[model samples]
Target: MLIRNPDISMSKANTVPFGIWPRLRRETCLDSGSSLGYASLVRNDCEKQRQIPVQLSKLSEKTTLLALVLGATLICGLPLLLLFKTGLTGNGGLDLGPLMEAVQSRSVRSALWHSVESSFLSALAATALGTLLALLIGLTDIRAKGLLVFLILLPMMIPPHVTAIAWIQALGPGSPVLRWLGLAPELGSTHPLYSREGLVLLLTLQHSPLVFLLVRAALRSFPRELSDAARVSGSGSLLMLRRITLPLLAPSLLAGFALAFVAALGNFGINALIGIPARYTTLPVLVWRRLASFGPDVLPNVAVISVILAVVALAAILLQGVLQRHLRTSLIGLPQDPLAIALGGKRPLVEATLWLFVAFVLLLPTASLLATSLVRTYGLPLSAETLTLENFTEVLWRQSVTLRAFANSTLVAGVAALVIAVISLFLAYFLAHRKPAHRTWASLALTQSEVAFAVPGLVMSIAFILAFIRPLPLLNISLYGTLWIILIAYVSVFLAVGLKPVAAAFLQMDGSLEDAARVAGAGFYRRMTRIFTPLAAPAAASGAILVFLTAYNEVTVSALLWSTGNETIGTTIFNYEDGGYTTLAAAMSVVVVAATILIMLTMNALARRVPAGTIPWKD
Candidate 1:
């Protein structure tokens, strides 16, 4: 506020910043008859005070953001860089000898071939199934579409290893459902899922939901007018779809395929638990086996393989980006409500088939998992006489490893979530509302995270082993087999997950509130705490919860990183199944799946409060 009538003798010069005093001196004009420039002096002083806080606040924020970005870049980028360095030149300076030799090795070549074959086959299957479902659900007036979409996506939410365990129980000789229906295989016969075809099947099942999500989103933006015009011109539905709809959707379908392929290529759980018995070896499984069986003695060889796998995944992503750009179709108008094609006379049949497929996908594994968890032993039938709570009790209460793993995963995931949330809150702010003068470093950090995420978790695990196997430079502390390494890796790998919703929230906010606050002399912290934080908290929490869920159940990243005491929940369950403790694995998986469902349901309850796109399965 300014004083309208100050005495001519008054001076507020000393209150202003340096150089402003000389400027104020030139503005002041003393007069005995009036207050002269007194009003201007006070007004200028008030303006200067307001501007000083803003300048200092921005300086403080910029300095902090730089420090944070530097830390983020190191955490996210350093490991991958070291991984490439070791893989490329560990043998000698600027040498390609080791990488070439490793890639050419018989075992390495076989694994690489297997990886590509399985990924390609599974990706094709996933794309076909997912695209069909997307069209049926998104473009047609299907009953229970929301519930159906959510149910269809549940497999994606379940950890791949868990899915593997459930399917094994569902179709094996001892399968409760099969036995109850008198359809069980011979007791001595080998399990069905322990084969190459089975590997591809599980991979397809695990990844189809990803394709569904992407293709459905694309379908939602499809031009309804084109479909109406085609129909009006007497084009049949199938023909029109083949000629128009599919062509427009080609880019999204390609992206879906690439995503599924990369996901399958780096898949660890299925490749290990299923492929190993099937005599199928993918690169991810090969890397895990090499390191686990041989330890760090074979780290250099492992690094080379990891680099190859990373290159394949990144290459697929880059190719998708290029092809998508080339295939992009520009629409002239805003996207309308999604196409709602009437299924007409065949609606009942189509709906019944969809329900049947959903049942086969969801109920079989879920029921088998519950039956296994309730039984006393792995092969025991789930009759009332055979049922017991011992398996759940053993894993949840009696077993030290399982209990420790639960605690370890909880602590690491919770800490990682909180850390990522805080970083995302500000990092997204800078990115979403960037100033020209803001450092380019924030974007560099963001890029590192995106790259880290795109690279497989198995590959990132190798990077961590290479980066942290040695004691750190300043601290002289080794993080190689420690939970801190997992924490850091999680923060690096899942940062993009945490950044997305907050960034979306930031983009949606009205800047007028902040401008008004700034005029009222609000500092950066005040504006952030009072305005921005409240506005973005729901979204930040959603992102953090997403990060926690992802990192908590993920076995791929922690498979190679887990030591005895620091075993994560995913690794512990995986090890149990690998060690022939099927009942224990099923019990633990049941707990994890239940928790995941509950959390997702909770998020759905709050979805209306957060920005869209945060909850993938939500409408």
Candidate 2:
């Protein structure tokens, strides 16, 4: 029988003695000899006190994480939705007429299909070529591997539009290729470059290096032991390659293909600079042209296309993410001895073929551009008299848009890089040190940042205009033509790029060190300043430089957004060419290329100074 009192309850029939929770239940109660229960009361009090605060802390952490995730999602996703939604709204309120017009338009259909075909073909070709190049450089002992690798990578450093400009100088409409074909003087009169094939070629050349870099890294990490074992088991090289290497490299190859596809699909710079002039139309150009010619009425259609492009990119990224996770989990952790296979008697032929390919793909266009820059005119007047520094002089003295453009580029890109780098470090730290209760939602918040990269630069710029223009009056700041808008756009566009490297660095770092500092009475910002920042400086620097270059060479976003006198080097170069300043644009390209190379070299040096294991993997 159990009895309840006003102050306490007691059970007399089946009472169990406690020792230590479960252990106590099976043990004897020494206090039974005494008519007292003081020990059990004290034990109960201790346990309850210990758990209450912990439970409360966990609840708070979870609340914080949920709030962060929701906030970040709205910040990153709302602009895109708003940019598109604005088209649905007018003075008459919500309207579906514009949406229907876009859906029913024949030109939009053609343009959409054209963009798809161009991007697919370009990405496929670049991936194939890039994969082959990676094999030659990474798997085999090719001569001049170091030098050739850099040269092959050079195309990636140059902006696609700048590369297009160089190609136009060398191959488009005129010059030696046409002269040899007996049609030099009448270049555009006979041969036109503004065609689908020309756009594909330009995109392929520009994007191939990205594929090469990804595939090369994948090749380096491949488990050659599997291949060797297959060989010893009487499997041929061809069989092993087809069964093993291709499948293993699939993730890397897919990632490269997806990135290239996304770039080609959304790229306005190349399409505008080369394709549009060739009288060819793609989705980006069509969107811009429609926007410019037809005003906001054409926006919903552009938004639809932008959303479609983003969805495709997102799908590809999701696939890549799944494959990467699988690969990590499936790692066998087997140790293998390094093995190098000789080319045997066919070494020279293999070497020659690789060199020939490198020369044609990497060196030829650049060489032609350099040659054109040196010559007085665009022909082969081999005499010393024909060669002059006049073009270079004119570029320097005219104090053309190039000078102002360079200053603007430096200011915008430099500031954007610094801001992004600092913000990323804190974000990474918060994410890495999140409590278990907060981990899930914090991760979700960070994931949305990746989606921004998939959006086309032009689409993002248009969204920026729609979102920012009206809010300026309410926000108490004029951002329309000021450097602030460009700065914000630049950071937003590249924040993911900066965050990924820094976050990876943070994750590799042991949390105990930060915990120790915290326990030792160090505050959040101080601990970060004293510990994590110094430790992650290398990755931070690398990410900042990468962001800067990305912003500096960005034409797609800057094109629609640039205000008068706020032009970047990229936009100005395009403007110069549009205004018939070919020689000056070429000279400016040289300057931008030189500056970019210098920055890259410096970053590589800084990266080398950091200790191994700091970067997670060799990037």
Q: Show the lowest summed lDDT stretch of 10 residues, model 2.
A: 23-32
Alpha carbon lDDT of residue 611, candidate 2? 61
Task: Tell me the spans in candidate 1 whose CA falls farther than 4 Å from its real position.
Answer: 1-51, 434-440, 508-521, 607-614
Candidate 2, residue 575: how far the Cα is off, in Å = 1.3
What clash count does candidate 1 reach?
A: 0
For model 2, residues 250-309, the per-residue Cα lDDT tens digits are 778888998888888888878888877777788788877766776654556566655545
Put down candidate 1 lDDT per residue, 1-619, tens digits, no spaces.
2323334545633234555555554444222234344555456565575567879988878887887778876888888999888888844477788889988799999999999999999999999999999989988887988789878887887889999999999999999999999998999999888888999999999999999988998877776788888999999879988999999999999989998998898889888888988898899988987887786558888888999999999898899999999999887666678877888998999999999998998889989999999998878888989989999999988899988998998899999999999998888777765475453666777888988988889999988888888999999999887889999999999999899778878888887888898777688788888999888887888788778888889999999889989999899999899888888899999999998889788877877876665565675
lDDT of each: 0.85, 0.71
Question: Which residue pairs does candidate 2 place in steric collision?
Answer: 19-24, 20-24, 194-278
Clashes of each: 0, 3
Pairs that clash in candidate 1 = none
